[model samples]
Target: MVTTRVTWDSLPDSIRRDIEARTGPLSSVEPVSSGFNSELAVVLRSADGATFVKGLRADHPRVWTQNREKAVNPHVRPVTAALRWSIDNDEWNLLAFEHTPGRHIDYSPGSLDLAKFVQSLRTLQELPCPDIELKLAEKRWASYTDSPELFAGDYVLHTEWSPSNVLVGDAALFVDWAWATRGAAWIDPACWVVWLIASGHSPQDAESWAAQIPSWNDAPADAVAAFAAAQAAMWSAIAEADPEPWIKDMAAAAQRWSESRRIGARSQTAR
Candidate 1:
């Protein structure tokens, strides 16, 4: 569910003027009904074309999220919509992006999009982490992990795994880099495993799909288990706080994944 939203007409006249100055006159605005952040998220259609814009007020507590998205855009442009411009002045802050034409990815078992998604992850894994400072996975999950060092790695990660965050077009495009993190390359695929499980795949099936990404395959089992436990705790807290259906489902999926990992480790120990 959209946590907050603002329509084009509701924006201050000054903000509207600033936006029009960047693009041509806005002929139409289409609000996108996805994402929990962003006070505004809409496609502004002009004589030239449509540009997607999502933003929040400067005073908002999570305003840093916009900065995070802007900073990582260039690094992930190969698999993301192009960032055209940004307005980060006194009152309003916003970003305009190349209006990507695509629908949310379908992560069901045997979906054709799986190959493209995996390729995107592989390509992303190869890029040098951008110089921009970001929240490290180890740091972000320090409280949840048995040892923060278990989360260490040098790979950049797009930590969100909601299907809505991905778009299927000429390629599987990952949108919303707001939560991008610097950590083990395998973390993103590990996060996706939870979503895959939430989307109806068994925990075993989810791991199989994740193993297709070489980093995930090469990752140490203990490190992955550490992440699984942390993720389960994180989702459980979110579910308890809000109790949204999606949140609860994902929490359950994460718990299931965590349990499976524990069971597998025991089996190996038994042998």
Candidate 2:
């Protein structure tokens, strides 16, 4: 599913010309790093200003992701880079965004960024999920869950929490909406806990950090348990499919968190 990363010049001249027609002549195109989805991630400089460009081929199988992102941006704008323009042509489907320069988030234990991240999640959880077609988290995680019913809710969730997906400026800016889903409000914080664990926080530490977020804190204990187990299964399957180190690490983290939750549940029952 991974495509070769492309630079500015890698784009077809016709495609570039089409893009330039809308944004004026591009003075320069500097490629950005840390993106896993888009083949093209660059900052295009023009007479007016710089714009962030993210795109893949128009015919790519994953082109639907671009449509999903473009649809979701207006809803999550304050917590994300503003979507400036969208181009759809035979050559490429590119989206230009207001370039927001900031450091990618650090999820390591005790990092000040953790509090800010929770705050951003709170703000995001408040935004209404724009009425659009989206994968339901319950259905998406169904194969991994004992009771999929527990996953239903009216909140739109951004399920990807890789450190690179969030940039910290005055506030944490979440990027990449391709995996966004509609489901339980607490699911996003639950997703963050796995990334925090993978980033070197202990399972208990990650849970404590997540508790700072209201949705996570207020989640029903049984529902949280279901979520943990579902994620453990989900990540384990992903790691098995492709034994990439980071994916494998996430699988292990999710397993550990799931085990910890199970043990806690048992102890509380026994008491």
Candidate 3:
């Protein structure tokens, strides 16, 4: 299991004293891992209850993802209300949020509750995206383009999509909103299929998952292969550059995604 380190800025004696004075007494100032930002402090004060304080570090590749998503996400209302709320408030250059309690989705590797996952994706797509001026998210897939072949068709892709990125709870709460971008929505679901395969799940076992979205079966096979290759190359670079210990499995998953698409293509041709 990967254990993430949580840390916070040193509270000044004045702030501590103010907190103590306002609240009856001080409790614990524990750090939470809701993000990979400057610092995330889950300050729990007996006097004022709880607040998630996020310290935003300027000029971070990671934080830029969150800002980009949050800006355009307002166009995708209720499906992304939590996001819209954050952007509209403009509350923090370095910010704090009220913590809402929720649980992550619990599905064994390869056995995704895909029905719900696809529904969630559709909901995100259905959201009305008004014209907004958010900077476009950086494309994660590049290695596949190294070959002489042309790149995949126009797609607003999220290079990162796995069970880890999605935190399903009372309302399919998607945490780690850093990788949000415009891309072929198919890439996300195909990425999931790649993840399932690497974890020792049979494609047939994931038939329920496969059945959940006809789009998977219907999308052009070449597109699927391109997406898988693009996604794989993207994360491999990320892992190599600044490895996030939690994502060691991603490299293998990317390979499987690319391979699966190839196998799928061969089968299509055979018929």
State the weakest 10-residue window (summed lDDT) of model 3: 83-92
**lDDT, candidate 2, 70-170, per-residue tens:** 99999998789899999987878899899888898989877899888988998998899889888898798999987998888888888999888899988
Who is ahead in TM-score, 1 or 3? 1
Give lDDT tens digits, candidate 3, residues 76-179. Answer: 43433243122212222333344445545544553345555667666654454345433232233443555313333233333344554555655554544445
Model 2 segments more than 4 A misplaced = none
What is the per-residue lDDT of model 1 for residues 1-271, given as tens digits with 9 covering 90 to 100?
Answer: 3558988899999999999998888789899988888899999999989999999898888889899999999988888899999999878689999998998999988888888889888888888899898889889999887777877788779989798899998789898888889998889999999999998999999999899999888888999999999999999988889898999999999999999999999999999
lDDT for model 1 comes to 0.90
Q: How are the candidates ranked when ordered by TM-score, highest leading?
A: 1, 2, 3
The runs of at least 3 residues in candidate 3 whose Cα sits more than 4 Å from the true structure, single-residue gaps closed, are 1-6, 9-28, 34-38, 41-50, 59-62, 80-92, 109-114, 133-143, 146-159, 162-164, 198-200, 203-211, 214-218, 242-246
Give the TM-score (vs. native) of candidate 1: 0.98
Ranking by lDDT: 1, 2, 3
What shift in Å separates residue 119 of candidate 3 from its native position after superposition?
Answer: 2.6
TM-score of every prediction relative to native: 0.98, 0.97, 0.70
| Global lDDT of each candidate | 0.90, 0.89, 0.51
TM-score winner, 1 or 2: 1
Best by lDDT: 1
Which residue pairs collide in model 1, if any?
A: none
Model 1: per-residue Cα lDDT at residue 266? 100
